[model samples]
Target: MAASFTTSWRCAFLALLALFVSGAYGQLSPTFYASTCPNLTTIVRDAMVTALNPAVGGERRMGASLLRLHFHDCFVEGCDGSVLLDNVPANGSTPAFFGEKNAFGNINSVRGFEVIDTIKAAVEQACPGVVSCADILTLAARDGTFLLGGPTWAVPLGRRDSTTASMDLANRDLPPPFANLVTNPPDGSDLIARFQRKGLSATEMTVLSGAHTIGSAQCQNYRLRLYNENRIDFQFAQGLKANCPQNGPAGDTFLAPLDSTGSTFDNKYYTDLTGLRGLLHSDQVLYPQNNQTQAKIVLKYKGDNTAFFADFAAAMIKMGNLSPLTGTAGQIRTNCRLVNPA
Candidate 1:
């Protein structure tokens, strides 16, 4: 009888464990938004400008300039994500040629998150305790998406801020602008294996890359795929070398874009990958039908643009949930750039 009781207790414990895992993994609180959300466009744009205030030439790509690119792309049709939005060249000069920092990508974007925190603080100071931190991220991403030719999916508000900042979590959540395909396969495990070691499916990888449709990709991040991938990459190597010349730049850090139209968030990225013009070889792999998961996502993006945006938002919420600080673990930082003093 004692043995029978022991087995029953074990079964009960296992059932409880299963329930916890299911709820934890499925924490899609669509109701999560700010109570007193500020005017998204104006405040976000201002915050981006303030962040770029310190940036000069090389770093200009890191702040206001990047935000404008996002705005330009998203606002093509009253910010409904018109593909007709003009493309801003990463190499834009003050003259008649290019768009500056067109390949700036998410290095500046992650910084934008920090800026959002500061901007949110200002709003909170004025209004006090009436916004959701998650709303800030959601709104910025929405505006950024609209700026890049993506649909503005419904973003629910009411997410509260944790009491802390984590450098590791920030680093882990953001994907490398150029992940080495040879090193990291675009499989379900690609996102998982690198940072959190949680395997995400090929569908996830493709949807996440759509976020790239609006961001920049430096040759420095993706040059190896273009110049060195004789094994997987066939064309564009010689020409790429003529321009890129090294794994990273020799002197100047700033460089050209991987995609010809990285600034505008549109289906162009998928279109380019299909014809073998994908800037990163990892991107090209999506089309070769080699990676089954990636191939499916490529086909989807190649066919429909709206679906990609929807998936990008969904995937972002998923990525954001990775290792979040909860239950008095983290402090709501007064200064996003630094840990809270108290």
Candidate 2:
């Protein structure tokens, strides 16, 4: 009788665990829209191609912007599309609410919303309220990365959009460019902690930082590193200083490529870190001589492009799966920018 009871208890425990795991991630499927919205990938890819075409009022850098938008969205509210909400003014009973767009790390920084709007419009034309903005953002990021020569991964779908947005959560959860720079030697503990809080490991944090390989940073984002930090390459600093002055807002908006090959997705980000040419203080801190583990991973990626691509794709998929709202939860917004009207 005792043995039978123990077996029954163990089986019940395992069954509950399986149910919880399925509820979290099993609902998402790669072919989720195969029957409902078959042309979803093509639509997103076409829009992305148009957006990345510089000849038609678009920019190649928009690929990086779109990818960054997805990253920012996922970090704040588990990839529920809250970051896309626009600020709403008080209308009688409805109180004023600021959104993630104007958050400290996002204001004037995250772009490609117009592109997302364009994609959302196209998707709506075909599927008509069947898809979620969260899924669109996820697919757009994957498409953008692949179009820009990065590894492509299978993005699980069926995510729902959040009707609400949170500026405070965005400001609090999104790691800033200077997060790892607060320490004397800049050990990267703070930045690691930030990613860890989001359920990412330190190695995953290092891998995701490789996304910096293709983006550009505003002068204001790296001004202190160019002028004050000793870890940066001297020539790199001098080159940047020509555009970013040491003491003013005048050159704040000036732009600098994050890596030598800024427009192409590759392992050059890790290579730059190996040479102390990483543009951001948070970036360079990953490969500091003191942090053997992170430095080793950086060096490994620097030499092995194949490994970098594989790990990056895996990390992206994991990040996309963060606390998604599926089943009947949340709503599919008609516009990526605003929640549907009640």
Candidate 3:
């Protein structure tokens, strides 16, 4: 009886181990479209270069927009491209609405859908009914970053788009900019929990937050930080306050760069925190006045740009892998804006 029990335990252990290995690697591959669409890379790159032409001022920010879109999509619904879905009439009685776009973290903030649409159109022209919108998003984000002088990584593909999207999940899951911020900011512990729930580590969270080096935030998102918080740089806070008054103004929609060097993707964001120049309370909490473990990690990246780039690339690939619908599951939506009809 003892021998039989030991054997059964070993069998269970082996089965668990096999499942883990398969789950990690069986679905995604760097060469997922090697035969189906060999020109996928060129098609995406050309669209990005066109969409992000420096001559066009607003389009230059598309790289960061794409990155944020990927993060928002992955966090809410495992990067299945559900965030890309447009809410249509449910059964001819319900009104049409938006999905993740209405989430607190995304409303009026997320952009770059046009760029994704452009890439999808080109890919479809090259190979119809083959490439997935989810895969295009993952690749375009990586290429977008690389185009703007950021790190590049192999984005494993074969991800499919979900037919259904959930505004409830988006609102519940996506981390708000104000999280862990209000009265004394929580230690990185609460912030870490938010990322861990999405399968990210604390170290990855810190590195990924560095993407803030490029984008701009609206006055509405950080006005409280400027007016209510005392930890900000005095002059910087004053400057922000000038643009964003306590009460709402018609120009409250104005923008401020998240980091001083808003166009460059670099370690300046970490350096900004070291000098108490973080833009959002969430940004400042990463390196608080008191010593914290997350602070130590941030300090390391502050001193090493190479390490930040390397870790960020790895983390992005990890993020892109979160519960993808590959193999026989989900569809390659011809239009990323709407679910392919049954």
- Per lDDT, the best of the predicted structures is 2
Candidate 3 pairs with clashing backbones:
none
Give the number of the best model, judged by TM-score. 2
Candidate 1 local lDDT, 187-279, one digit each (tens): 522333443343445576666665545444556666666655644335545555676667555512445554556556667778777767777
For TM-score, candidate 1 versus 2, the one ahead is 2
| Model 3 accuracy (lDDT, Cα) | 0.81
Report lDDT per candidate: 0.47, 0.86, 0.81
Clashes of 3: 0
Order the numbered candidates by TM-score, best leading: 2, 3, 1
TM-score versus the correct structure, for each prediction: 0.60, 0.91, 0.88
Evaluate residue 167 in candidate 3 and report its C-alpha lDDT on the 0 to 100 scale: 85
lDDT of 1: 0.47
Instruction: State the weakest 10-residue window (summed lDDT) of model 1.
Output: 76-85
Global Cα RMSD, each model: 14.8, 8.5, 9.1
Q: How does model 3 score by TM-score?
A: 0.88
- Candidate number that wins on lDDT, 1 or 2: 2
